[model samples]
Target chain A: MATESGTSTRFRSQTADFDAETGLAVDAALAGLDALDIPTTQRRPLASRAWAATWPKIGALALFLLLWQLVVWSGWKPSYVLPGPGKALSEFGSRLGTSHFWDALARTLVRAVEGYALAVVIGVVVGVAVSRSTILRTAVGSFITALQTMPSIVWFPLAILLFKLSESAIMFVVVLGAAPSVANGVIYGVDYVPPLLVRVGRSMGASGFSLYRYVVAPAALPSVLAGLKQGWAFAWRSLMAGELLVIVPGHPSVGADLQNSRELLDTVGVMASMITIFVVGVVVDAAFNTADQRMRVRRGLVAEGTSAVRAARGSRGLGVAGGAVDPVGSSGDGTMPPPADPGAGGGDGGHSGGAG
Target chain B: MTAVRSDTAVRIDGVSRFFGSGAARVQALDNVSLDVRSGEFLCLLGASGCGKSTLLGLITGLDAPTTGTVDTTNRRAGMMFQDSALLPWLTAGGNIEVPLRLRGIRRGERRERVERLLAMVRLAGLADKRPHELSGGMRQRVSLARAFAQEADILCMDEPFGALDAMTRDLLHDELERIWRETGVTVIFVTHDVREAVRLGDRIVLLSSRPGRVAEVFDVDIERPRRIDSARVAELATVVTTRLREEVGRHGH
Candidate 1:
């Protein structure tokens, strides 16, 4: 027991006994240690990285198109009914140039923007408010989660009843579909923020709304962004459903055209419109994923910004925020400790490197 | 408020902190009291579950004692946690600038102050590096810089170097001591390492665990620039450790 005490308190730096040479040597060692801090990884060029990310997606598109063409030539269905990829591509191309198609596209795009904007405003306001109040959270937290899972199609009947067969009806459903996800995003984001970061902020003299703004809000951003992505998905689906159900006269919308093509049995037109929907879905989803990915990379939560880099690393998906992820990614600012592992912990690729 | 208390940076009077309520109530500190003199380096030393951190929280105003008072008067406190607690999203310079920005310091001034703090911590050129980009020691250095950015009179550190390797911890000890001496900022450093406490502290306050109470306080008469390996430091550390073990022994069945 006495020996254990002696060992525990053992000290090594005896500068009192150190002569001038030893001190200079120690200074060199210290300087060497300082210089040996891990080197920051170089960023790949933007054009190359962009190309790298684009290729696999392009390759997948080619593979999908080839299979679709093969299926048509295989006589699985008549050409008129199913249409070949080539035929559909040409039809979509032709539609792109036509005023009629552009008008329908504009109508669809306009509705999507308006509905989503409304949903975001409502969702963020409600989500932040509900998260802050214990009583409100207890009252409506679970309810929001329930709404997120509910098929937005379920809301169309009620929306129609409230707003009639107009743009408002479509917008009502879109906002309903999107808001819960956004609100839930903010709530969960706020709830999951690490208590340690909050304590640091408080000690730094952050209080009241500024604390919320600088610390809590920024810390909660990752989850909130996730929520917004989910919310957009819901809003898009609702708008599509609304466009089909509440077809207003004089409005040549994407959904209305889809309905018209099916009724007229203009199979090529139907395929083209279906292509439009699929393309829009892919594009919007890509937009959200890109935003999320860039944000994560910027915060250093993930290894690299480009999807190609992530794919190469065999990472399952964009990393979540925490010790496992990175605060350097999309969270509150602080001198947060990296995880235990050197390779995994530091903002980008950290190492507990250097001993001199 | 009185003239006699003018030199005291912090005065804790009969502070007893309890968690929970009723039968489940757990007392973390039992009538713990100490005075942190202005511009002095004080170490709160004890084993795990000793309420060393609880006491720190009280002094920092992050938590309050259930009984008694902790009076820091008008002086603000800046703290360093075990984890760097650096916002992962910001660069090292950005992290140091947090407190300054919180006080609504303008952007130009914030940048200039962050640069100075970074240089003070021996991290001059790496301000733009994010927390993850730097090593553990580097991150901790940034954390230290951020704490100092608050420009508070009292600095509270909760095992700031506990997770670091021996060499890094030793180096940081030198850095912290140099900074303390240069700035004359009163420090209330918490640590479990006996040698570490002896190496850095002006006086060591040892608390016994399980309803922590002050078992003893030792004045470290060792001269400035005392290394952890010094004979005098080792001697004091050994004496303190023996008493700490005795306190820990009381808990054993």
Candidate 2:
């Protein structure tokens, strides 16, 4: 009994030592990750990281404004044609205080949102149909590609002819412009889902709709997100064009504002409206970028955290290869030492590391 | 080890499988017949393109035989592939929960079963980890747990450990053998490795390529906990390897 108790005490101490060793190794590995600008499990506060990301964008905008001011100062074009940056800025500031400007912005945004939602529904249905059936894919696949490449402006005339310069005309053109790209994205995503995953799903008794839901959809998500981003670009551009062409009597949109500014020879208003459109595009694109980045980081497809940390690590010449640090923490877990054969463990380690 | 029961877990009779048609047609399996006894660890040993995996497909109902029959008594068969095939989106525990969810097991039961399976595979505390975050061996272990979670009477493994390093493979052999012994589930393991077959298989059936057919069947009388490098396993492997080589030689012409 005494010997057994002594043995138990010894085992407890050994376990304690092993746990301490593992803790040290984990700390060291996390430090190495920090040195490489790779985030460990617990990252820094989100707000600071977001601020770190935002500053560069702000800098780029400032540089863009400086460039615009220099171009205006060069006197290449008359002030009537290309307004000075200060003139546009003052127009923008004044516009921000006006209720009419906000209403116009809101109207344009609502139309774009409605059109985008419709495009998503149409694109997903058509894409899934074409992807599932060889006949549909063969017959309509090229047609869809052709449609995507076709100038969206071509659809505007038909849309206006059908709806007679109404909001419906604008929405019709927006849907037409975006749906093809979204469908193509879904098709490509479904086509490229790893065959092995499908087989695995099948082995688990997943069939038909369940198979698509549990396996196909999730696997195709990254590509689908890519397509959605592309589709949004098309939708946004088409909406702007539509608003410019099809002016409803009471609805004052950014696109309508551009046309009015052009007609009235308010060059500063036109430039300000153009800047607003450009900023809107950038802002929407940034939203999509953030969503895509989050998905990529979650999948471990890309590294997370601030580029400033990456640059700092780069300057230090640490050159620690990504995905090399053992996450299992087995190196220091003495009690659960890796498989008896070092060669075997080493080979698998190399393989998984390279794959990651 | 339990006595090899007379009751069969899987039976394949006069099975022939052909892929494509006319000019492009290629026969994958021809007149292959076999019976896997209940609670037996049977290895389907063959060369590349020997239809070992095709035979597994037939048993698992992933593919139907063009001629003849593969009867698993309509019982669902679990399968593990060469790759881990764990869903990237799901965590290790979530992957295991897939089959349980499919089988319509209650949420409470699924959670309990997933934990048990994870512990069985020695991957406890790794439930929340993504497949990419884990080692290859760990991922494979998760895959194994996923297969076992199906609770099928028969488990078909298609060279599941072929991509694993030797040490990991050896460790897994021990784990699989222990699991098989403990659960008493019938296992039909397909592999090209003769030592692995000898190490794990209670019965080894050799197949020849070019319209794969059963070339030989050897009853492995080795005791439980057989080591891959054991002299007894080596002795049996030599005899099986010689027959396997002869089968491969026949295809050389």
DockQ top scorer: 1
Report, for every candidate in turn, its global Cα lDDT versus the true structure. 0.77, 0.76
Model 1: lDDT of residue A102: 88
DockQ of 1: 0.34
| A1-356: candidate 2 lDDT, tens digit per residue | 01121223433444444435443453354334324432344465668666756676777779998998899889999978988888898999999999999999999999999999999999999999999999999999989878876667778778888999899998898898789878887887888687888899999999998899889998877667766877787788788888878899999999999999989999999888988998897778667767755654555553455222343354421222221122121111011111112111111221110010
Model 1 lDDT per residue over A1-356, tens place: 01111111222233334324344554565566666765455566778667666776777889999999889989989888989888888999988989998899999999999988989999899988898899998898788877766777777788888888999988888888788877877777887777988898898888889789768887787777777776776777788888888899999999899889889999998889989988897787667666766666656655564333344556643322222233332222332233222112211221111100
Q: Give TM per candidate.
A: 0.88, 0.84
Residue B47's lDDT within candidate 2 is 95
Task: Categorize the docking of model 1.
Answer: acceptable
Residue range with the least summed lDDT across 10 consecutive positions in model 1 chain A = A347-356
Q: Give the TM-score of candidate 2.
A: 0.84
Report fnat in order of the candidates. 0.35, 0.23
